[model samples]
Target: MIDVVVIGGGPAGMSAALVAGRGKKQVILIDEEKPRNAVTHETHAFLTRDGTKPEVFREKGRRDLLKYPTISIKNSKVLSIEKKAEDTFEITTESGDIINAKNIVLATGVTETLPNVKGIENYYGSSIFSCPFCDGWEMKDRPLILIAESVQALHVLKLLKNWTDNLIVTTNGNKIFDTDQKKMLEINNIRLIEERIIELKGIDGELQSIFFESGEKINRSGGFCTTVLDNRLPFIAQLGIKVNEAGFVIADVMGHTNIKGIYAAGEITGPSQLIVSASQGHMAGAGIIADSCEEAFQSIQK
Candidate 1:
């Protein structure tokens, strides 16, 4: 059995495999390649890799992992996981191959559900983004709109204020904010539109204007929105790994889950930045190495 099988190819998975390989542990990195940010044109806030294309960053990361002889990467989808023995897991892939590993790094990131706005997908990852900190700099000082369906909209609105003053907030038919919040926004010169969005008109993936069901329209160059982050793997709960109320996998600082042989990292633990995910993966890898070494040493004592 391999020392570790990382079940996601994002920054966290790659980082964990890197650490394990450096520690001379056999590691396998499996990636489905269906990243949540696949539509994003550029990735930001990752130091030394800021403004890099999402695919380009991944390509570069895979190349770095290839340098380690003990680390192997498999471009395939994981279908199921079964516990074969203590501290061992049998991972079955869509390719029909079965891999056994002493440790697991569950790094499958979250899937996003944007506000129920028409044609949002065309503008998403282009003009309409989820994180202001990631794309706000590019759209700073421009007329922008925030389409949110959750209370998290309030937090995003506050953050976007730093980038632009000409902003509009719409709940897309959901009354996520109350009268007090509406007055607060109006006091700050921010417009709040609580109508349902009919359509978002854009050109070349660039959002231009949003049309409401009430015939109200506003033109915006670019902006951010709030999205629901969900775990794609429901079967993870079957593994006896604990999850928090926010639907995030519960893991300690070292990425150790309730299950002794398994670890959780990246967006699975929670929505995380690229740098943070990578750091978590490094920690999980180190934890596995430390635990495995102790296990072997105790076996020798027996």
Candidate 2:
């Protein structure tokens, strides 16, 4: 059995495998290549890797892991996981291969539910985005809009103000903001449109204007929108990993999940930046190494 089996070969999974491999543990990293950031053009806030394309960053990371003979990467999808014993897990892949792992690291990230607005998909990852910190600089000083369907809209609105002065907030008819909040935005010279978005008209993946269901329209170069994030992994329910009220897997700062032999990192734990996710993966690697070493020492004493 391998010392660690990391599910999802994104930054978090790759980082975990590298750390565990460096600790002299045999590690297997499996991925399906459908990362949450696959649509994103470039990743930001990762020092020395800022503005690097997601694919490029991942390639560099995998290349670095090649130096460690103990680490192996598989391009595959994990179908399910069965805990056969306390220290053993049987992970079934789509190809019908079964992998036995002493420990499991779930780095499967969250999936975003794009708004139902027409033509938004064409602009997403280009003109429209979720994180201001990631795409704000690119749209700086441009006419921007904040589309939200949740309370988190307020937080995003506040963050976007730093990147653009001309801003508008819309709840897509959800009424996420109250009268007081609307007044506050108006006081700051920001427009609040509570109308439902009918469509996003753009050209060449660049947003030009948004049409409201009420026949109103506003011109916007680009904007950010709030998305519903959920952990959609079937193994989370199968393994009985505890999830918080926000529907995110619950893991301590050290990446210890409620399940003894299972740990989690990256967006699966919660909302995290790229660097933060990588750091969490590193911690999870250390935790796995410590636990495996302790188990071996105890076996020797026995």
Candidate 3:
């Protein structure tokens, strides 16, 4: 059986496999290539990789990971997982192959629900984005709009203020905030619009204006929107793992889940920076190795 099986080939999964492989453990990295940020043109805030295209960074990461002979990557999706024994996990792939590993690392990320505004998908990755730290620099010094549909909208709008001065918040007809929230935003010169957005007018994936259902139009260069996020896979529920209210896997500091022999990292655990997610993967991998070693040593003593 393989020592470790990492699902999802993003930065977190790759980082975990590398660490496990370096520890002399046989590791398998499984990925489907359906990345949450696949639509994004550039990735930012990652030290030494800032402003680099997401694809470029991933390609380079794959090449570097190939240096470890003990690590292998499979271009396949995990359809389901079953616990074959106390210490072995049987992961079934979409291609019908079954992989047995002593431990499993779930790095499956979150999926974003884009607004139903017409023509929004065309500019989703370019002119419209989610993370402010990732795309704020590219949108600096421009007329920007914050489209919020949840309580998190207020936080996102506050963060966007750091990059652009001319900013407006579109609640999209949802009143999820309280009076204090409205007062704070008004004090900051951020206009709050509760009108429902009907459409996004843009050209060549560059957003130009937001059209409201009330026949009102606001011209803006670009904007960020809040989204309700869901896990890409329901494997957490299938494995009987506990997830936080935010729908993220509940993991300890070492990435250990409530289930035995199973751990998780990356966006599956929570929303974190690229570097932070990678670091968590490294820690989880090392923790798994240590636990396995301890088990073997105890058995020998017995």
In candidate 1, list every pair of residues with a backbone clash: none
lDDT (CA) per prediction:
0.90, 0.90, 0.87
> Scored by Cα lDDT, where does model 3 land?
0.87
lDDT of 3 by residue, 189-295 (tens): 99998888898888988999998989999999998988778885767888789999888999887889998889898888988778888888888888888888898
lDDT of 2 by residue, 1-302 (tens): 87799998888899999999999999999998988888878898899999999999999999988899999989999999999865689999987789999889999888889876777889899899999888899999999988888889888988999999999988888877778988889898899888999989989889999999899989999999988889898889888999999889999877899988899999998887888899999999999888878988999999
> Candidate 2: which pairs clash?
none
Q: Candidates ranked by lDDT, best first?
A: 1, 2, 3
Residue 208, model 3, lDDT: 95
Q: What is the TM-score of each candidate against the true structure?
A: 0.97, 0.96, 0.96
What order do candidates take by TM-score, descending? 1, 2, 3
Report the C-alpha lDDT of model 1 over 50-154, residue by residue, as the tens digit.
999999999999999999999999999998888876668999998888999888999999988888887899999999898887888988999999998998999
Worst 10 residues of 2 by lDDT: 114-123
